[model samples]
Target: MEARDKQVLRSLRLELGAEVLVEGLVLQYLYQEGILTENHVQEINAQTTGLRKTMLLLDILPSRGPKAFDTFLDSLQEFPWVREKLKKARKEAMTDLPAVASVRLPRELSLPAQL
Candidate 1:
């Protein structure tokens, strides 16, 4: 994850918790690799912190029933973060990714979010 993404996750961790951090990081990595689009990030991030929003961000059990949700989940699982887990994965070219989403980040890195 990028420093900025880590910063965002760390800030969220304080308001949320470690589980949220993990889910946020997973979504962050997805965003970085273009699995999740800018619109998707913005929509999800705008939601108040909660399991429903988290599930939407994680592409699980979305309000739209199984068909819509499954398609999104399938695409997400094909993201480099998932597909490259066991391989020497290079960062996907930025040209291939949607423009970076403007997620809120804390001004300072919380200790746990530091590298």
Candidate 2:
């Protein structure tokens, strides 16, 4: 078998384990609890499958190694509000950008004429 396939099979062993499934399911339950705001919900919905996959990955990270443990430790230090935002981000990174403003872009994002 190809090296990548071997890695994938090895990873499947961990992610599908009972403890990983329980933790991932717990996170999903928390997400479905109606605590997240509308924008949060929309963003999550935008990448629903990817988010589910990441949450699964999170559960398997410990099996992956020390860098994974470091990431876990860092997560513990996140600011409360930042951590709240990241709970969603932990599952969906791209969909977690700051919300957009009115129809026009924010001035920080606006561009002057090419001239």
Candidate 3:
């Protein structure tokens, strides 16, 4: 396994799920490679931290030394288990409200009627 792959695999082993950082980057790269669907990216965007950090991770990866992440990603194309997990995670995320969604507007506060 590539080194980055090991880190990613280890994280999954520990949590039984994807690392937010790693998953985001993999999704971005796959999108760039034209292997991922736009709907999937949109769904991921609604659920994940915005793409900036994920982009940064991909941009900086060459400097982080070797990793197994590439191999794992390459294997995703044929890995039904990984794909099932990804779909399930996405399903769960779609139902999860954004952090800000819980902060409700004041019920009694009114906005000025006139502009």
Candidate 4:
């Protein structure tokens, strides 16, 4: 996942932990989507509390590669408010990017210099 997406997840960690039902369909969906491995699901299910399970899920997501964020978002279908909040955060993050960052440099200028 992108750094901005990871940051958004971290920012909403507390809220997510409070609202996520770790023992429910979310984890199964993530596993089925291939975003979470069998081991990952097992680890999360082993957590003693809902909050701990969510925290572990949050911790694991950033390292699960690019599609993890979106797949995870999709798994939140039961929690429309949480999904909306995440979507809004993503939109805000995109808008907050500096205009200069979106401008592509000329090929020659974009090339790396020799050491």
Candidate 5:
């Protein structure tokens, strides 16, 4: 994941942990997309509370490679509000950067909507 993306996740950690529902479909989706390995899913699922699960997910996602951010974003279909928050954060983070620095960053990827 990009530094900016990581930063966004960090910034929203509290909100996400409070709001994200990771017990069922979210975890399944991420695992299916290859963003979360079986071990990762097990580790996250092992957490006792929703907050812990989400925090673990946030911690794991940054290390999951470049596609992790978008794949995770896609997995947020069950929580469109969270997805919008992330997209807005990403856009805001990009615009806050200096022109040259922003230019060096990867462009925002357009992801297909979850049906």
Candidate 6:
């Protein structure tokens, strides 16, 4: 495979795993909180499936040029509110562990004992 194809596959693997896990967690929480109804869950599942179908179609295309690849990249848009909330949460979590920000280990200690 070409470099671009390898990079795209690596990114798709990472993103697909992360999206399914995170969305599953968020959906479960929302359901428990009574924020999402059964119908809402069904609708979200359908949407997620549609997205996967779209990605599969794109992946199976015979030839993809830069423009096609750029379009694919553009489709993976991040939700603004979700991104902001995650950023805020990460900042809060990091604030409680000030020493973690400057963590380091000696080279000898960083490696496994077997090495």
Clashes of each: 0, 0, 10, 0, 0, 0
Residue 55 lDDT in model 3? 45
Question: How close to the true structure is residue 8 of candidate 1, measured as C-alpha lDDT?
Answer: 33
Candidate 4 runs further than 4 Å off: 101-115
Give the alpha-carbon lDDT of every model: 0.44, 0.40, 0.47, 0.89, 0.89, 0.44
lDDT by residue (tens digit), candidate 4, 1-115:
9988998998888988899657568999999999999999999989988899999999999999999999988998888899899999988998987776577899877868765
**Residue-level lDDT tens digits of model 5 in 1-115:** 9999999999999999998569558889989999889999989989988889999999999999999999988988889998999999999999998766433433466454565
TM-score of 1: 0.32
The alpha-carbon lDDT assigned to residue 112 of candidate 2 equals 82
The candidate scoring highest on lDDT is: 4
Distance from true location, Cα of 34 in model 4, Å:
0.6
Output the lDDT of residue 40, model 3.
49
Candidates 4 and 6, the one with greater TM-score = 4
Error of 4 at 19 (Å): 0.7
Those runs of model 6 whose alpha carbons end farther than 4 Å from true positions after fitting are 17-55, 78-115
Return the top candidate by TM-score: 4
TM-score-sorted candidate list, best first: 4, 5, 1, 3, 6, 2
Looking at candidate 5, what is the lDDT of residue 100?
67
lDDT digits (tens) for residues 1-115 of candidate 3: 3343433344344333333344435666665655445664565555545344344433333333343245334535545566456445545554663565565568577565676
Better of 1 and 3 by lDDT: 3
Candidates in order, TM-scores: namely 0.32, 0.22, 0.28, 0.84, 0.84, 0.28
Candidate with the larger TM-score of 2 and 4: 4
Question: Model 6 reaches what TM-score against the true structure?
Answer: 0.28
- In lDDT terms, how accurate is model 6? 0.44
